[model samples]
Target chain A: MKNPLYLLQRALTYLVLIVASLLSVFPFFWLLVGATNTSADIIKGKADIGGALIDNILTFFERVDVPLVFWNSIYIAVTATFLTLLVSSLAGYAFEIFRSQVRERIFGGMLLMLSIPFAALMIPLFTMMGRLGLINNHLAIILPGIASIFIIFYFRQATKAFPRELRDAARIDGLKEWQIFFYIYLPVMRSTYAAATIIVFMLNWNNYLWPLIVLQTNDKKTLTLVVSSLLSGYYPDFGVIMVATIFATLPILIIFFVLQRRFVEGMLGSIK
Target chain B: MLCGGERFDLARTGLARTERLNGWMFIMPALVLLGVFMIYPILWSLWMSFQVGRGMNLSFGGFANILRLTQDPVFQRALSNTFIFLIVQVPIMLVLALIFATMLNDSKLWGRSLFRTAIFLPCVTSLVAYSVLFRSLFLADGFVNDFLLGLHLISEPIPWLADPFWAKIVIIMAITWRWTGYNMIFYLAAMQNIDRSIYESAKIDGVPTWARFWYLTVPMLKPVILFTSVISTIGTLQLFDEVNNIPPNAGGPSDATLTLSLYIYNLSFRFMPSFGYAATVSYVIVILVGILSYFQFMVVRDKRR
Candidate 1:
């Protein structure tokens, strides 16, 4: 029989795990329940689902340009994700396959650049964007993010797992290098792309600081900016704000759940 | 024989030339973009830091901004607040993550995936959305106070967002909530890579459970612990979203939740645009990250020896 102390420890372990899980999940539950309640009910600390979800959503829609904001977010995120993946992957593939001393030094330098926080670059980037007449444009967001150093690092790490024989075989077939990358390398490393797609999409979709600074016009704002603006109103309707929060959150949550495994793989791939 | 050798040499050179060309072609787009966005901005910011100005009226001020920083109360507040967050929140969150990761690493643990998924769920929400949620939840009459009152844990509602001290706590709690599971995932991954036989041998030798964990598991996870701590430290130093959003005054109630990043934002845009001084404030974050990361690496390396 197991000792009493061991059994007690096991029981305590389960208890702690259960508590932590509940705490982790509680806010999400509150978000949903809060969405369904009236502003007054929420303020009164109501935890149960109420009959105000439709009202809240309608109020949120009225206060914000729902379709336009979502479109803006989706358009920027999709374009940025596609460009980042394509550009970073090509660099990653070349860095690995065409390994050279000069290129290796450049790659190392780029990695060091990763530690330079975005806060430092924002002022200059803003000025540069203003000079180029790109401020408040969606391209302003898309262009700068396309060559993400972190994603490139991730792709390079994942690329190490890519088989070399396939490349040689493609070359033997007289396929040009670009054609080999498109036809052979692309299909073979689809999982890596899928993982990267989810991560980059989430990042671009949820990007706050840069967009907050650059996108000044109401019409140009993304759903994230809209939600924050909604909260800043003097009388922030909790119910309505909850709905907006959910709308902003749902797309990435859906993507995460749908591509959950690859998302996990993508995260693990980063530190490897 | 000489003609044949020259032809072979020429063929090899031709192959090398094509390979080099292809490599440059492949990497050129990303390199050019990074050059335009990252390198240019870094150099520009460095130059801008030396030029003191308000709005567009600028003049060169070499050591002037540095002197201002030493005397600036707001800058000092932001720097100290950022360090407080880095010191307090990072270790708490990382320790919790490490503990949760070890518990979840148990093969015999039931509903392991459910717990893991739940813990990681917070990462899915956008920063703004989560901050909004937390703001409502921590309001004076919000769910947190209600729950605490119900449990008889408090005699009166605590002003979570309104008070200076509690506001900082709220930001710390919000960050810890959002990132603990993310760090936990790293630890869990590293823990899984650890061979199970090490534990089995320790158990066979009658090593106590706590001793086995303390001596064996913690030592093995040292690298990951170090890695997560450094990442968390960098993240804490750059804390902005939660503080900027959660507080009613946007890092107010006497600027208790004001971070260096938020201060930089205010300097450049919110207040009168002192772009030069703002750039200077941002450099402090860069310097802090460099020093803290170096210390973390050294501490981890020395412990290993």
Candidate 2:
């Protein structure tokens, strides 16, 4: 009787997990399928693959400035990722390495700032960017995100795992503060950086609200903004939308795949 | 052999002072950027909230926007919709995540890494892509309706986007599908950190599986549970992308899924720009987040006591 019950429990566990996995993964599969079908087929709930991949890709590129829009997304996401990693990791390293009363208070204040919704700040932020003549420039998108409080918090938590002795030894060797950081600390924390890179890149790549408000011109839009605008039209082509989505999703997916291990580890570091 | 002048100066200033200055120096870039972008904008929004007027033209209203909030039916609908999402979707996602995490934590579980990757994949999916995919999936003649109809679950296709109540349900489903795995990853990480000996002892003592999960696991996971809940609360209160992208025209079908963030967007950008009233609506989010988070923290605090 007990053995039968145990078998039943095991069966149930597998059943639940299989269902959850299918639910999570089926969308991407369907998304790929959708990209190959025409709009009418998609509307008809076609489940099978079609041979319109080339046609969809051609239409998507023709409808939108694929190269320019993709370049805009890449430029913004890459620059923002690099700058965010530098600024936030430095602050995190500093808060941990040079602990002080004032710094602690400031850190707490920064956490409170994190809770304030970005929606509240968008209008004023837009107005401020407009004043600076950065309304259509990519810099407006990159600037506000360079000092992400969330990334700073993540780096701070990850830095807790950094060995103190390395810093002490580097100082004893007469390395300047900056030299110690550049030569020793940075080299040691490669996995943390890898994890941060994946996360920050995905965030900047998929960022919608701020970019939607800031970027006005059709020529200046990122892939995400373009995809959104495409949907807003009177007669959206599902095939084209799917193709754009696939392209929008590819970079982040690639990053996630390449750095899967470190990404998970980075999350673990933050939780600890 | 350190440089003599630099060494002498460093000694005179003292290491603490050097550390203090270095700390400030390291954080200076972030602080400057945040001050200009985050802090300045936040303060500007606060001031704007108190004023009254249309775009670019404004004057001090002294609580006029606040009073306007009371009479704004659209704002009222958005607030209720956001709360409904917060109250319903968050718990469902968290509990599902907890269950999945616990199951995945078992070393004997088959295909653990595959399951973990599959589950976590949704969170990394692009917002626009996910929204577009969901809108298609839940369309009147979409795969979801087709499947349900084939299964004899319903007689007719549900008007997912056209109906107000169903739109909210579709929004909830979309959010849950996207976020449950994200939360599960957090819980899984925390679960991995739990000492294995406790579980081993429970098994040896013949404690049932459900009892072990409830008694042993839940208590240990309280902190992360609190953390995920607080985050999900903030995320839900400021819900925008799902509703905005899923529904037509950013918030359509009679504003059934109009989140607070979407409303703020509509006011500032979509409609005749009312920056002040929009700013005022934006504060409604801040106040709600503040109150809800405080209550959450208080509840956690009391539990410890």
Best candidate according to lDDT: 1
Q: Model 1: what is its DockQ?
A: 0.79
Which stretches of candidate 1 lie above 4 Å from their native place? B1-10, B295-305
lDDT accuracy of residue A90 in candidate 1: 96
What lDDT does candidate 1 reach at residue B125? Answer: 83
Error of 2 at A127 (Å): 0.6
Q: Residues B1-305, candidate 2, lDDT per residue (tens digit)?
A: 24468768667578767777999999999999999988988889999999898988999999999999899999999998888999999999999999999989989888999999999999778778899998888888888999899999999999988899899898899999999988998898889889999999999999999999999999998888988998889999989888888876567789889889999999999889999999999988989888877877586677779
True contacts kept of 2: 0.78
Off-target runs (Cα >4 Å) in candidate 2 are A267-272, B1-12, B295-305
lDDT of 2: 0.88
lDDT tens string, model 1, B28-107? 99999999999999888988899998998879999899999999999999999998998899999998998899899998
Best by TM-score: 1
- TM-score of model 2 (first chain only): 0.95
* First chain TM-score for all predictions: 0.97, 0.95
